[model samples]
Target: MDFFKFLYRSRSAFDYADDNPFGISTLLNAIIKRLQQRRKLTLLLAACLCLAAPCYAHAHIFSPLLEAILPRSSSEKPQASTAATDTVTSDTKITLPTDLSNPSTTTAPAVELELTKQPRPPLSEPSLYALLDAEFAANRGNTRRALVLYKQQSFKEDATAVFERALGFSLNNEDVHESLDFAKSWLDQNPDHVPAWFYVAHLALKAHDYTLAGETLNRILRYDPRADLSEILIGIYPENDDDQRELLAALQPIDSQQNASLSVLKAGLLNQFNDPQNALIHINRALLTQPDYVPFITLKADILRKIESTETVLSYVNQARLRNPDSKNLYLYEIRYLLDLKQSQQAWELLLKAQNRFNDDNEITLLAALVSLDVEQYRTADQLLNILVKSPAYLDQAYYYLGISAERQQRFEQAKYYLNAVVREDLVLAAREKVVSFELLNDNIEGAINTLQLLRQQYPVFAPDSYVMQADILWQHNEAEKALQLLTRVSRKYPDNELILFARAQLLDDSKDYLIKRTLLNHLQALDPSNLSYQLSYAQLLLANNRSSEQGLELAKNLIQIRYDDPRYDNELQLQALNLLASNALATENYAQVINYLQTPYDVLPTLRSGELLLRAYQGLGADEKVEALLADLQQRFSFGQRNVNDRVQLY
Candidate 1:
């Protein structure tokens, strides 16, 4: 202990001089004198020596950590600092020496060693403060400052700042790629940072970088495969031809063991690509995993509907309804399938049932009106539409249906009023038809023609019927040549239309030769072979044009035979056939056959043939009873019976 104290004497003397070196010796001598007077002269030296040992021992113990405070100029101010801005000093006082190799080296004899003190290059307070302020500002969620600082970094800590700043910016902004790039930098610095990995993977997904996203997701799975992020990874991963194959390969370990929702999503992807067969297989597998998945059931039903297996679709939808009875959308799906089958009445019944389950639902009500209209249940449709128009959700569609229902009932004025409120141009043609027909029915021929002319001006190429309508109006007004011109234009554009051919025949028959009329009639007849009207017109045309005596007779016979079982009577054809038979008999001078035909009779009233001509035909045949019977019938039918009697007598 004495030797150890002796070895540290030099450093102790140096510390004494540094603090109170010159005055300490004098104070010690005075203390010795005072002790001599108080205690005794003999003990004074021992007491001074004993105190000096402790002072030396204390100095030696602290020498390794505390360095000497070197004397400074009177004018220099002691540096003030905090942890963030602490300055390293040459004159170490109590701080631990950073360089442990030279622990004994001292700034002052009593203080710890200074291996080296390379004073940091002086930075202006404003500049140093700015650097720290920039760090705070970067951390303050300012992306621009953070990016600048990050780019300027050349150290680990600098990179750390950049990573943090990037994360902040990413969360603040919505650009997925920018967020991903920043997260990548952060991952480079802190590859094991879980939140950073999570965000990077998420951003990759949002950026639609499937390859990058998969890689990031794989990294996460490597660390935590069964983490909450597994679902997210599956959602964003590609499901294309090659990708699906790859995914199936990757998911082999978890094939039938995946969570219910993931399996459902996988099944949906298969359905989207039109592989419903495989999709159904996957969905069944998913249901075995979790039978109560409503979304899965809904998806199955939807896919069934897509393939037009309506019965199966209905079956699945019903099953889904049983499982989740409150599903409005499921009922809607059922209604749509029923409507597609033309089972509108059945669809309406389902809609009514749905209404009971979900009353006042605007969508269901709108669907109801549509089904009603489809089935031609106009009155029921009108009632539903009228109620729907009051709700904002269905006003437009309801109004359109209301107009259609009015049109069906021949309430043209009301129909037009409602139809005009419908803004869709697709409905314009139907609206124009109803409006024009209404005008024509009201005896407003010019108005009807003008409306059709307007339609032609608006959609010239599409509304070819306008030309035909204009021709008919013109012919009715006695402008035969103008009517022919319009009819010719329409016929040229729509040469195959039987209506155009028929209309042309009527126009020509009024003003042209029998041959020309017969040609138009035949054109109509050839296009529409089954129509009784066209057949009758063709027979009449043949008779007038002197086409062939046998041909005309055969046409009339064939028309009667073809139309014999037809429920609706071809009144015009039957009358024309009877008149033509009488005319043919008279032309051939077959008096017996003429009398036979005339006596057999055709109609109660001779709408085509004059009554006097009938009486003449009876007289010519010498059938006085038939003539007298016709007179009595005429007396009952006509007001001027006696006045109308023409006595010059030849029926044929």
Candidate 2:
């Protein structure tokens, strides 16, 4: 029974100029309005209203609430006494009609309801006394106290009227646990009551007790074979394997009915449980039931993804897309799967079809642009990105990609213009850095430095990286002294900056300033002791210093001792360390030890440094034939600028 509607009808039509005097609260009205369809507990409700009918003789409680909230066997009429409230059976279940004749519930809460004790003569019924104030508190917006009073008057023996009212209050409060507990109590009293079972099953679902919900749903279906349980079933979410298994087992009876939506839900649950084999069985069953169902179609693809190859999955998705041409999600999935398979031509063709069908959706247009670029369709990428640039949301990214497309086509001038137009802070730095590459490619060192300086000016956090790049440009242009000066100036400003210091030390070493380079490498070690590159630099610098041969040899030996299994050891580092050891031995004229160290490194990588060291070792051992053979190999393999191997060995 919709008590709120019945309460609405009870308000007399005195035409009081837009006002309702019954004082019904909105919270209770909204919660109770959903229950108007169940027409089976009007008898107990009519008695509850009959008590109020005499109390507020002005309310004119004339609505058919008596027979609606408590449904009878159609042969028996509602009696004045509460004698029939003791039996909990199908005949006693409340079934409210959905017809609402009055709009008082919406207008009632504005006027305060004061059903004080001086209203009427005393009655033996205690619930009648409390009901007056309960309605008063409800209209006053004190829903908690109103619900407390409603629950107080509602007992198991003869409490169907007030108990359902209390259940409505509990729903308004959003107390799922409390509602479930109260629903279980009401169900315990009324074992065969469909309305009670309906509420109990839903509350169990809300509380995430899927086993109890599935069991109660079975009972509800037994009584009312056409009950719509879509709301309750949609809320099933199992958190783990055990919960999934329990819920799946409980739903066995429901699954045996072979309903389409239920089969799909079960299939989804099985998929989430990672049992794709069983999930496929149920999804296939659903497809058989409803062949064109989109969810069933997509779920089959998802299940196949776990067991099938990408080619097979993409074939299935393409077939589904062909069948459902208007499905936007299918188009998106097809594009994604085709891209994963590296079939960009197919993806591009599908995207063009989607663009035509979808009227050039901006997101799809942007995706098409990226795909065109991937497939080297420069003209198509340019066209799509140009359109996307008109929209504010996609403007920043559009300009950025337009720059990349132009740059890839060797349109350096146009690339710089488009990239420079990107004003987004995240993309601006990368865009300007690309411009620097274009400048350097044109052999314009000044332009590259100027661009880097602009970046440093705009984004100070990246100033150190920009400064390092500037120094590299000078060093690459054969201006070593100028590069050293720039690094020295920046290093002074950022004395503790490791990147600048490392760049400065490399420049110093290349300029043959070993004393300063060695000092800088030592300071770097103190800053970050685990820096293996710095350690390698220190060993190489010491080996080059004639006076520190013993120290250099010991450090090189320590470095080479790190085995292949060690995290600190990589092939390049080991080879570098070996070259250092062999160089130290050759310096000391220990030809035998030099040969032993250089043999493995020469075999692994015949780099100029290792080859040159081996040639020196062979010469120091008086193995003239080995020295000549090694020199011939080095000449064949590498360029020595204007100094060929024969010309260079004349110095030794």
lDDT tens per residue, model 1, 243-315: 6555544443344333444455556766766777767776777677557567677777766766756677787
- RMSD (CA, angstroms), candidate 1: 27.9
Query: lDDT values of the candidates?
Result: 0.58, 0.70
Give the count of colliding residue pairs in each prediction.
10, 19
| Residue 113, model 1: Cα distance from true site in angstroms | 46
lDDT of 2 by residue, 463-537 (tens): 888888888889988997898899899898999999999888888762379878988988999999987778877
TM-score of every model versus the real structure: 0.43, 0.51
- Candidate 2 regions exceeding 4 Å error are 1-179, 182-206, 220-230, 233-257, 307-316, 423-652
Candidate 1 TM-score versus the reference: 0.43
Measured with C-alpha atoms, the lDDT of residue 282 in candidate 2 is 82
Model 2, total clashes? 19
Superposed on all Cα atoms, model 2 deviates from the true structure by an RMSD in Å of 13.0
